[model samples]
Target: MKAVIQRTANANVTVDNQKVGEIEEGLVVLLGVTHEDGLEDAEYLAKKITNLRIFEDDSGKMNRSLKDVDGSLLSISQFTLYGDTRKGRRPNFMQAAGPEAAEELYEQFNDFVRKENVPVETGKFGAMMDVQLTNNGPVTLILESRE
Candidate 1:
């Protein structure tokens, strides 16, 4: 499992021109699942991201966790994170998990994050979505379970 997390002032997801999910003063997570991913991977990322000290504290230091900042989460499944472009002109997606398995893990990841007591919003698992966000501090990080 992999996730691209971005601190955001606000975020939203739209599908078929209809808003599906949204959040304010939180993180936007673009999550990806590979064939080897399981519940453990999902749980691991949830814990890591929720506890990550990316938010600024009283002294303007990046020392506050999402919990400390009272933030929310907007999670979206994005298999494209596994797109391997090392070869020819086209990107290879062979490392990405099949839709059925990926969707299950995606839901599990969101559920685990929710268990951390932070509000969670999500895009449709297998839908084409338009995501919008105002990135706070432009802070972004890429996390992966395998390494």
Candidate 2:
């Protein structure tokens, strides 16, 4: 599993011009699942994301976790993160997990996040959705379970 997490003042997801997920003072997560990923991978990332100290303290230092800052998370399944473009004009998606496996793990990831007592908003899996956000501090980070 891999996640691109961005701290945001606000964020929202829209599908077919209808708002689906929305958040304020949180992180927007573009999550990807690979065929090798399992429950442990999802569990690891959920814990890590919730506890990551990317938020700033009153002294202006990056010292606060999502728990400390009272933040939410907008999770989106992004199969294209595994797009492999090394040898062709077209990106290869062979590295991505199949839909059934990916969706299972994706839902599990969200469940684990919710277990941590944080609010979560999610884009519809496998849907063509639009995401919008005001990135706070321009703070962004990438996390992978294997790493």
Q: In model 2, state the lDDT of residue 11.
A: 98
What is the Å distance of residue 36 in model 2 from its true position?
A: 0.9
Q: lDDT values of the candidates? A: 0.96, 0.96
lDDT of 2 by residue, 1-147 (tens): 989999999999999999999999989999999999999999999999999999999999999999789999999999999999999699999999999999999999999999999999999999999999999999999899996
Local error of candidate 2 at 5, Å?
0.5
Q: Which whole-number lDDT from 0 to 100 does residue 6 have in model 1?
A: 100
Candidate 1: regions farther than 4 A off:
none
Q: Which regions of candidate 2 are displaced past 4 Å?
A: none
Candidate 2: worst-modelled 10 consecutive residues by lDDT: 138-147
The alpha-carbon lDDT assigned to residue 138 of candidate 1 equals: 94
Query: Residue 133 deviation, candidate 1, in Å?
Result: 0.4
